[model samples]
Target chain A: MTKMTIPLGPQHPALKEPVNFSLVLEGEQITGSTVNLGYNHRGIEKAAESRTYLQDIYLLERVCGICSHSHTTCYLTCVEEIAKAEVPERAKAIRTIVAELERIHSHLLWLGIAGYEMGFETLFMYSWRDREQVLDCLELVSGNRVHYAMNTIGGVRRDITPEQKTEILRRVSILEERTKYYIKLGTEEATVLARTQNVGLLPHDVAMNLGTIGPTGRASGIKCDVRKHEPYLLYGKLDFKEITHDTNDVFGRLVVRVLELVESYKIIRQVLNYLPDGPIAVKVPAKIGPGEATNRYEAPRGEDIHYVKANGTDKPERVKVRAPTMANYVAVPYMLNSGYLADAPMTIAAIDPCMSCTDRAMVYDTKKNKVRIYGWDDLRKLGIEHYKKRGVDFSKL
Target chain B: MSEFEKEEKLKAQLEDKFGGAISDMIIQRKDRVWFEIKAEQLVELMNFMKTGMGFNRVSTITGVDEGEKLGAFYHLTDENGIVTVRAKTPRTDPHLPTITGVFPGAEPYERELADMFGIKIDGLKPGRRYPLPDDFPTDQYPLRKDWKVGDAYPEEKTSPATEAK
Candidate 1:
């Protein structure tokens, strides 16, 4: 039998971002695989070195369009530690609310994407429709949906008002009701079961060995949630359960995320109920005293870690971010390899990969004795030419 | 029995194992701990931390280029607590032994360190350029203090992480 390679993405319709995987397939069962990431490397860390900490916060938020709040919260928390600035009680509570809202929206988005992978377009549409409610609540509180510049240096930028609080809960209640229906479909639906159950299995050992984070690790019964582990932000004060499952497969991941949505609802409600009266932010000094700090946040995907070192200057000496996607990709081969070819999309989407947060690619131009950088336009042109060479009229495209 | 005591137990275990190799033990926060050591002792220390203390998860492997010295910080954690080991390597010919053999999970981070700080992870496997364009200038390390947006070689105005957004 001849072993053939099936390459998926640096650009694929199924993948949300730019990631390339070469799966060596022998009669539809992947015998071996290799991943080529960095197609979306924006040089965030290197760029962070240039920007002031204030501007870097916004830049970091752009790292992942889905979980922007997670990046900002983690970044602010680390810088706050170094500055020794105390975020007011009210600010902490607001941060938790926004963070949980982002979690809900992000999870729903993942659910929708996973649904698409399973060819369940209805589930995809319904999950995304519910996701909008969470985003609406987020907008009500933070004034923006995706890159909510809700977090600042010392604390949060805006406080949730009483009217906004009531409205948020009103929307969240409806979102929760919709989530229950989705969870039922996720578990009991026949097609979903066939596609997801007993697929992309990651035993406890494999998860730990690969250092899978967030719900992926929890699905394998690892108990590695940073929210519980470190107790950053209001996570220490908030009352919630760390959702986990023992299924150890794609089904397990779905269960963990769907159930976590319920927990996020409870957490957001608690943060609002116990909302304290205080300033949202304190005056952080222009120059932070020389210090180093590490902050971790439980982003919707998993643990997002940021390391910051200040040289008593406006700009940080160095900033390193290890997004959960980086830790989770090692499991891709384990999940995708040796499976029926049809399961590849669900297995890959199960990790909820954010390639924008994970990649950096540089092309070597040996012929020109220089490197050639290809931007989006260049790639588009190449795609059009390939289709034209395939005897298609791209002018119509 | 107590939280700090449990952290102390892990620290004492590491201190017993590494001793003078870790120049100083600095407890940054409640759950966060830092250990400063030389670059040569890093891989062995990382292996010891995993095998000896059962600290299996590495939060991240960070490469920092201080104006004078280049550094690698290994933030390791598990169910017990978090431990960060900071080791400094020389600026010229910057190199640190890869801990992938120990942690296996440290490979991506080590690769990023190689690409960004230009810190050679002695035994890192060959892979695609990380978090940077492959055609990115070879010699100019991006994160170094001296390596500004257009400092070393002004081949083109843009940078690796510019699209890194």
Candidate 2:
């Protein structure tokens, strides 16, 4: 029997990022996998060198959309470390609230995508419909649903108004009830369990070896959450458990994410009750001082690390960002090549891959690789050849 | 332990490791340590801390493009607060001894630093490009100071999430 490799994508409808996975299959089961990235390397760190510390906040927020708040919070934490600036109590509370709310929205969004991948269109629509509640609550406080621009130098850019707080709590209560139902349906439904439960079993040692982080790492028994470990902001003060599972399977990942929604709600409630009173932000001084710092925070997915060096100037000398998804991608091949081709889309979707936000193709006029064909013609030819080999209609191709 | 006491203990441990490598170890405002070390003795100093001291957790490995040369930062930590070991290698051929064999977490960090800064690490697999695309042009490092960022680079402008949203 001859074996063939199937290229999943540099472009696939199921994937949000341009991660090309060459699935070497023996029949319908995946035998081996090679992962490809850099379809979304936006030179974000390098761009920070040219921008001011204040400007980098808005810029870095654009690095990953789903985790934009996390990115901004992570960057600000590192800079705050270097500047020795203290974020006021109210700022910390507000930041923590936003962080938790973002976590809730992001996990729901992932659950929705996973549902969509498994052909559960109703679940997908339901999750998104519920996600809008959090979005509306976020917009009510931070002005924008997506890029809230809620972070500043020494503190947060905005505060949660009293009226807004009531709305947030009311909406969160609704979400909590809805989330409980979704988790019950997702985990207990026989079809959903059959599709996911034991499909992608990333064992503990292998997960650590691949350097998987966030919920993926937690799913595999690795207690490596920045919140639980090195608590920055109000995470240390909050009263919530580090929800972890040792299964390291697709179901384990799902459970961790769903439970995190509950934990996030609890943290949000704590922030509201213990609301602090103070200014939201303070003016940071600009200078060329010889100081640098590294800060890590728990993003919705996993650990987000930021390294900031300032020469006392308003601009950073160098800024380095390490996203959780970048670390978790290392374990993808390990997870995908363990039987079940049909479930590949959902298993990959579980990682929530976020690439460059504005990835544009730059076609240089000079290149060497036979006679290059452009655009749809190339795709059409490949499709025709594929269908012809499979004895399918060329017109369908 | 308090963050200040954590810094103090780390400072004493560093001074004991290399005797004179501790140029300045101050507890910064965040209660994190800012430890400065001489460039030449960094790799040996880090090895000593790993083998001798109890600084087992390797938080991150990063680089700063300092025009003519690059400054390497090995952010190491434990239950005590963070301690950053600062070192510099020439920009022309920035190379460091690989710490992956000792500290397993450092492998990905080293690879990322190598790909981004073009810094070579001795003893690791010579050609391991994990994240950079295969067709990505040679002689160009994406995270470097002078990588071409004109309209010609495909990933020069945006991220997928921005377009998706």
The best candidate by TM-score is: 1
Q: Tell me the spans in candidate 2 whose CA falls farther than 4 Å from its real position.
A: A286-288, A355-397, B1-60, B76-83, B100-111, B126-137, B140-165
Encode model 1's per-residue lDDT on A276-369: one tens digit a residue: 8989999998677589888788999999989888989888878888889989988788888778777887898998886322212359988888
Expressed as tens digits, the lDDT of each residue in B56-153 for candidate 1 is: 88879888777678888888888646688888888877888888888777778888888878888898888887877778788877777676666545
Which residue runs does candidate 1 get wrong by more than 4 Å? A355-397, B1-3, B151-165
- State every prediction's TM-score relative to the real structure: 0.89, 0.82
Which candidate has the top score in lDDT?
1
Q: Score the docking of each candidate (DockQ).
A: 0.36, 0.23
Q: What lDDT score goes with residue A118 in model 2?
A: 78
Q: In terms of docking quality, how is candidate 1 classified? A: acceptable
**Whole-model lDDT per candidate:** 0.83, 0.78
lDDT tens digits, residue span A202-316, model 2: 8997776555778888888878777877888888888998888987788888889999999899999999999988898887776434577778888988888788878876778
lDDT of model 1 at position A53: 86
